[model samples]
Target: MLSTEDLALLEAIRETGSLSRAVAHLGKAPSTVSYAARQLEERFDALLFDRRRYRLQLTPAGELLVNEAARLMQDVARLTQRVRQVANGWESRLWIVTDELLEFETLIPVIDEFDALQSGVPLRITQEVLIGVWEALREGRADLVIGATNEPPAIANLRWMQLGEMQWVFAVSPRHPLAKAKGPITRAMVAQHRAIVVADSSRVTEGSTYGVAGGQTVLAVPSMRAKILAQCNALGVGWLPRHRVGLATRLVEGTDRFI
Candidate 1:
């Protein structure tokens, strides 16, 4: 049986189009890679390559093997990624807590991207309040945490990767009485309507660092789903990500109460 290293060299040589280049890439002297190839030629008892004046050309059998080896190389790459992820506690082992309200716009896309790129690295995510998400990560209850942040990041043990600017928008259910206007919503108008807002759990500070306006007081709801559910009742307005905006709520542009 050919050693795995032998198979790897075959694939690498095919990829780089030169035995010397493959040896250099693998940090092996040219002679070592050449010896491996010679061993394979002897085992098969057939000329796999036709040496030319200036370049090496694969014979028919050699070309066929290279094509088959390409498939094996892909499998090996994915396996290697899984092994690395497992070694680092990243494979089948990501725990995330985030606002359920941000599902459509931000959450789903982020989850999809990681899963696709990492392949076998499965992610286990939880939907929780902004504050609860922070607590989950901080208390070692979760692996990754995300929510609104106006100041510097605060998770001490876990590292945070910023995903660009997360923008907040105002959404009122389509069934609301004032759903038909182009003018900006005043804070006073929002107070007159029922309002839904996400509250942090034990880890979050009670007041807004982003600040709220329009005389609209926020009713702190626990998780993202709960906030959306409450807002879905058509009795109130709430904050939502633009990526997740839906038919139930129309975004109130300016002068809308948001935090």
Candidate 2:
């Protein structure tokens, strides 16, 4: 429970190594510094100065106190700064939920930029699919949501902006029948094959799916990446983000759409 003044007095005495020099360094009278030094030792019930030494050095106990107290002061300063930041509208901890359709790797640069700010707010990033992204924000499970898909639903105090649109391509494994389909793949034709889909993570709300026709057989997977893998392995066919399709899968022509 040492006060800042006590810490400063100890530091000055240690640094200067003489009562007269410590008083000069502290801009205090010699008698005042001497009396304060004696009070500090009495309060702690430990000899803090090596007065027997001609140079007036600090005892080991005094050195330990100064070093530990300086470290504690630094911790207090950091805690104070974080408290003020929270008071100024920064969240003490941030939980960000992104749609599983959005690759987590794409947000690395933005995360690095946030780290550079040294805001001291802890960040938690998670992923949800389809309606689950919106549900996370609505249910108070998330503080921020990134790359959420579909029209945003009504939620109290919700705020958002369009990051950008994603283009979708109907993709399938090269060995799949659709890869060699003769003409434009109609909704009827798509319905004939099992559609791979990432299941919505929503618990409270009725979740939704996209691009699947009525009565179509579905292979519900855990994430968009799994859906892509299922399609690439000829497990099923479905629309996928164009950027994620790559050469491993063939894109069904004439079905490009933006969302």
Candidate 3:
């Protein structure tokens, strides 16, 4: 493999058109440049220069190496610039995909604060369910997603680290008697009252216990928002992801409320 100094020496020779000038430009003795060039010529089994006492001149092969060396130097310059730019935060777009419910609380504020300090670090948020969110990141479409993953699908390319667990809860429309029920509302009791089940997944959009059915009557909807909206519209009781709860849900007061 050609070393960086070898390429530099080749480029210096082309620029100055003299071995002595190239060595002087490097602040090194001319013999060092001559020796390095000797090594390069021996490695390639070719003459690098048509040497004359007055000044150095390029042979045909030397001319080719000089031109190619110039191209290589340009590439090295661009690579150095790119590295410096990254170190200075020149490319700072952060792509995020998360359950839409994040707008209400923690994640939103964190993002807001990040934007305040690092306005240059732009963040773009998109809505995606757990697996789809992970898929987006895997497909190079997103940087990360904040949501629970369980029995996660087997994908060789996917990678994730569980940050922490979230609290879980069940909710019903305030109009439901379960909201006012005094003591343990037994599973049988809950079954008796028609709970507004959320068919919209966006309502049930927290990152926990997904795909685990809780309600006796279940309705499947597309997003967490839609699921919660269906509940607002007097749909069946929603087995909501606790964090996904909106302002109005009445937390069912009892154990065995969730499965």
Candidate 4:
């Protein structure tokens, strides 16, 4: 049976790409590391490393073992963390709903920090738009909601906090007629073209829309990012979050003139 140390040794060699480097990382002498690897290989009577090039390359059998070991180690880690969490009386799961306007990438560091705590609280994240966030909380679909824009309805036992304001700007592609139209754009001018809008993800609520003037052709998208891309491509025109406009500008700078 392979031990955790043996699996760790395989992982180190895979990461460093050299036994000498891997040994330094493991804080073991080169000879000792080599002896351990050889013993492991001999137990199965199969070559673990190619040993042809100067670099540490895994053989077919070695590759298989290392890959399987990685999954096994992940399972072991999660199991250990879950046990520790149960002892500490932590929750089994946490459901979170975030507004579509907020960038999900910003939550990466927060998720990493949470994982480090070994809280064993499995996180389930879902995206919502406008009133969908409130619907999620009201219907018990989510335990917490982030980036809720509107005031919650008069309901008992509801809690909320302000998370700052989100700025929006009406944008158009330079190739679009509105971009070249003289003076400020009016509702009539906007009505002549298609408006890009993200569909609200609320199931219970009827959902909401903004900046779509009366009689304007609507092109509904799944996410805020998609709406921005549609506008950049001149597929439709609509308001986009201020910060996302910069990225959209860069994306279409060379190929298309995005205003």
Q: Report the Cα lDDT for candidate 4.
A: 0.86
Q: For residues 161-181, could you state the per-residue lDDT of candidate 4 as single tens digits?
A: 897887899999987889999
lDDT of 3 by residue, 172-258 (tens): 666656778898867776665444432222232443334334555555566666666666555655466666564444323222222
Candidate 4's TM-score: 0.65
lDDT per residue (tens digit) for residues 1-259 in model 1: 6567877887887878777778887899888888889888998898877777446678899988778777777777778888887787654567766655445355777767775774676667676554555666667777766653533346665565665676667877666765765698776666676667666554556533122456666677665556666666665676766654553343333233333
Instruction: TM-score each candidate.
Output: 0.45, 0.72, 0.45, 0.65
Clashes of each: 4, 0, 17, 0
Over the stretch 1-259, how does candidate 2's per-residue lDDT look in tens digits?
A: 7877777777676577688888889998888888988998999999988888678877899889877777776677778888999999988899999988787778999999999999977899999887888888988889999988867988988888988999998887877998899989898998999999889888876688888999999999997767876787889998887787763343333244312
lDDT of 2 at 117: 100
Instruction: Please tell me which predicted candidate would have the highest TM-score against the true structure.
Output: 2
Candidate 3, residue 34: the lDDT equals 87
Query: Candidate order by TM-score, highest to lowest?
Result: 2, 4, 1, 3
Question: Model 4, poorest ten-residue lDDT window?
Answer: 250-259
- Global lDDT scores for all candidate models: 0.66, 0.83, 0.66, 0.86
Better of 1 and 3 by TM-score: 1
Which portions of model 4 miss their true places by more than 4 Å?
1-89, 255-259
What RMSD does model 4 have?
A: 8.1
Over 4 Å off, model 1? 1-93, 104-123, 146-148, 151-153, 174-184, 203-217, 249-259
